[model samples]
Target: MTKKYAIIDTGGKQLRVEPGRFYDIHPFTSMGLNFLKPNTKISLCRVLLICEGSNINLGHPWIRNAIVRGRVLHPCFDKKKIIAKIDSKHKTRKELGYRQNLIRFIVDSIWSNGKELVS
Candidate 1:
């Protein structure tokens, strides 16, 4: 059997996802989905494309009735990013650090057209 995978849009970004794998993603704040508790079930419906073996399915913007289900692992902070600015002529230096909040989840299943693919 062929493994199924999909491309999905989340938090203004596109991600290629596969079932049974864990991924970190930016929380959807507009939908009030930040800081979700661990083990919570989440469903992503903005499927851009789906591929299985030699067959492929595409969406105009998003495929209707296509869903990817996952289980939340935890809320965590991403790696720190540092920015430094220096003006040697003036003997001035500035630095800044930033880290983004993210949620980790493991994909459980992909469903479309009444068919379910579980990893």
Candidate 2:
């Protein structure tokens, strides 16, 4: 299996990820209300770094030969979240709730240096 690196953009954030590794991505809803489905395939167009074995290539805007592939595992929310409000003098208190949509992806491959990793 060939080894390579790829850069991907998720939820307006760019990430450098690899295969066999898992990463947290922003909720699909963040993209737009149109994207509310779970476990959907979304292409990440931002390529930043591609490292293959010993050869490494970097993108000016994006590496010409780098491509990263990933799969959306599931749609969920963070385990721990907190929202609170308080007023000291008035002794008033309020609390808010939050549960953000999150996606877990498994890096399928990082194509760079004219090579691709086996899935």
Candidate 3:
């Protein structure tokens, strides 16, 4: 059987999510990061689109009453990147590192068009 899925945008990034799967995503908002601890469950209402066996619902930006229920699996840091630059003639060198703050989530259910599907 084919499972349904949805596309969602959070923290300025787009993600394809399916039920019963875990995805590491950016914190939904800057301030929301401060209060959301691990194991907290949240309802994401920013559903861009939903598809189930070719039955698709397109939204004008987002669908009304479409929500994805997920649990915060953990709060962690994402990948780290190192940037380095060197100038041979001027004898200048610079190095910098960047890491993104993120949260891991387990999708529990998808509610679309007044119907709920368990993941």
Q: How well is each residue in 42-81 modelled by candidate 1, as lDDT tens digits?
A: 9999999998887789999998899999999998889999
Higher-ranked by TM-score: 1 or 3: 1
Give residue 20's error in model 2 in angstroms: 2.1
Q: Please, what are the lDDT tens digits per residue for candidate 2 over residues 43-99? A: 555677666677677778776766676677766677656778999999999988887
Pairwise lDDT winner, candidates 1 and 2: 1
Off by over 4 Å in 2: 1-3, 28-39
lDDT preference between candidates 1 and 3, better one? 1
**Candidate 3 overall lDDT versus native:** 0.87
3-88 in candidate 3: lDDT tens per residue?
A: 69999988877899999999998886544777778889888899999988768888999999999998998888988999999999
lDDT, candidates in the order shown: 0.89, 0.69, 0.87
- Against the true structure, whose lDDT is highest? 1
Pitting candidate 1 against candidate 2, the one with the higher TM-score is: 1
Best by TM-score: 1
**Model 3 ranges off by over 4 Å:** 30-32
Candidate 1: residue 34 lDDT (0-100): 52
